[model samples]
Target: MIGRWIFIRGQAMGRRGWLALAALFIVALIVLMPLRMILGLTMPETITARSVEGSVWGGRIGDLNAGPLPLGTVDAGLEPLPLLIGRPQFAIARDGFSATIAPSRIIHANGSVQIPDGLGGLPVTSVGLGDFSAAMADGQCTEAQGTLSLTLAALGPLLPDAITVSGQARCEKGALVVPMRGPQGMERLTLKIGGDGRWQADLTLAGLPQETVEALKSSGFDTRPGGIGIGTSGTF
Candidate 1:
């Protein structure tokens, strides 16, 4: 009778060991299965997603931690998996220009562009831009306030001898408008280039040079009566 009892106790202990092993196997499978699926994923169409609210856990594994994401978002329309593991590329249209950018929370983009021949045409081919910044606001595109330097090799053959115009411009009416200052000592100057190849400038010269005053007298730039002498040299 004592031997039988010992044998029964050993069998029970072995059964308990087998049950524990089976439980561990199940737990391992549960943990690894989802990770495998996530790693082997691909998306062919756009995915709409919302933030996960609470924590989740698995038995004998661990609690999963997920941070807050944007509330409601529509990803790129191509599907399988909406999230990309690596850098993404996309295009944005704003202010009459379309820009291609790297897809990220904060993106850094660099590319070469050509200014179009007309007011609204494709960009130039050889001209380039460096360190351009853009941001997404309310699901729309907005260019960040910063300096953009542009280089053009040949501007349509009409510009004066490959002229270089480098200055800061403000974004207005879907264009970059730069205000050029007049010549020295001139408060204001107006220049007009007509379609018939005629060029003219209206200038206000306050403290005029002696040579310029003499020339004005000869060329009829002097409009004042009684031989008035303007006391300054400037352009308007």
Candidate 2:
């Protein structure tokens, strides 16, 4: 008789625990319904969201876009249990990309960004080098893994006849220095970005052959002591 009573008590406690968990889940859903609705309606002009529905604990954003960049759609949800215990957490995934976002720069993450053809309206494109120098150089390229900023004025010094410069590189950050040699001798084109995210450029031409220097001058470029100066700015 005593053993049977003990077993019955244990089963009852288990039932109570499960019932409590179910109650909390319902409460969480109710509390987060309004917030999820607000986020859906307030989607920023810079971003477009599709099929945004679900409570806080679980939800899906079908597709998203910002300017020329496409973020596709993703499924995401809030994880309040971990957050309540002092660990901020969330989840995201879209086709080939997946990551668990948290504080501390990054943790428990693995993903890759893909550009099938290339980004639009920007300086460098996969198939084209539009708006950049037409200079007939060896067509050098750097890592495509970082941010590149530059002004259009920096590209004009290229020989006008030259067009459609193409090379291979991985994406990356830092100034893009193009090495070109001609009658002006050896020099580099350095494109720098300002803290304000503006593009500026300089021609590091020094000790150029006089014939080449004069040629650049005649091409509508102003000469500094050591190099030719050129540049371009927004909406170029």
Candidate 3:
């Protein structure tokens, strides 16, 4: 009788062990499902992409666009642990550049992209996002780093050479601000972009040839302390 009891008990234990293993396997299946199943379920309004393909562990986002900027096709992968807690983090990359995107922060490397409509009607043909990183908490900018550049064209004879203005990015009054300067500091452009896609730019010109200054003034630029200034605002 004792031998029979022991055998039965051992069998029961083995069954429980198999049950536990099965439970773990089911959880893994649910967590590792393909990302394509949920790609468009809750996409943000400010972001759009041509398509996505692959598993949650590794995927691709094709022709992604953030606001008005186009981010080329990028490889993406999710951090599974974070997803478990409802805060999904993605590791994204394209070409040689990489970045991490989370709920409250974004970090990216330098990249040059063309702007179809330009920036706030400033005749900017292209924009370079150089080493940009920004973080937010409680709807406020907590940290910011990196620089940005804008290339301009169609200035007629006023600016024969290609004009590229660049400057470091910072946070001010809960907005991302970039104060760019042209060669020789002869021109200044302060650009601000808010979280809601609203943007504004102030362009000022100084230390230019008298004829250049006159030309700008004739083009609706107001005379300021150091030179002529123009302000424009629009949605990004």
Candidate 4:
């Protein structure tokens, strides 16, 4: 009789153990499902910008929560996951207006993977902006205080060695104007940077336009060879 009682008790305990395991498995599934939906998801387009002086200013929707919990609430029932991770793309015309001093068109632009702040509260990845313009205009320019600031690393390998100018350009009263210091003591030169990443400009001592050739000479760019020496500079 004692043996029978012991066997019955053991069976009951085994059943309860299986039930508990199933419940734990269901709970884990419920928790992880929402988490999978939040991370690394593509987001609706967004736009952000910074000034040439390096000030960040833009707005974007943060991580999205899938479960039915109030936004920004970190209670036991809430899951905070990021919906998208990166700076929003913006149209140049929508953000501001610019009159290209020269005829130009942007061909292509892309960026690297953007990671968001994880559960440990680390900062999200820095935003990246990349663009290409042809026959970049030279004219009057005006831009918001903080509309064109980009980091060297974010611009990619080829861009770090190229000169990048981001600001507003406009034609006022039939004259080109830019928000730049008056051309006084600075060496000014018109550079022609091609979309294929080729750099070329007038580089002749005697066979060049008199004004352009003289200007190059004045800037100490006059060298023995009558060809332009193309090289890269470490300023973007």
Candidate 4: residue 188 lDDT (0-100): 20
Off by more than 4 A, model 1: 1-106, 115-126, 136-147, 151-159, 166-236
The residue-by-residue lDDT of candidate 4 on 95-206, one tens digit each, is: 2221111112222222322334311111213222234222223322222122221111212232233222233223333222222211231212222233222332221222
- 1-236 in candidate 1: lDDT tens per residue? 99999889767787778888899998776444432132124211121223212111111111211111111211111111322555333332222223333332223334433343411121112332344454433334334433233332332322223322222333333322332232332322222222222223332334545665566556334544333222212111
lDDT per model vs. reference: 0.32, 0.44, 0.78, 0.28
Error of 2 at 102 (Å): 9.3
Q: Which ten residues in a row have the lowest lDDT in candidate 4?
A: 47-56
After superposing candidate 3 on the true structure, give the runs of residues whose Cα lies further than 4 Å from its correct spot. Answer: 1-32, 36-43, 80-86
Residue-level lDDT of model 2, residues 71-173, one tens digit each, is 4677766557775786644465677555443331122323333334332222322222222221111222222222222221222354433212222222124
By TM-score, is 3 or 4 better?
3
> What value does the lDDT take at residue 199 in candidate 4?
30
Model 3 lDDT per residue over 66-100, tens place = 67777778898877776788877777888745676
Report clash pairs, candidate 3: none
Scanning candidate 1 in windows of ten residues, the lowest lDDT window is 58-67
Ranking by lDDT: 3, 2, 1, 4
RMSD, each candidate, Å? 19.5, 12.2, 5.3, 18.2
Overall local distance difference test of candidate 3? 0.78
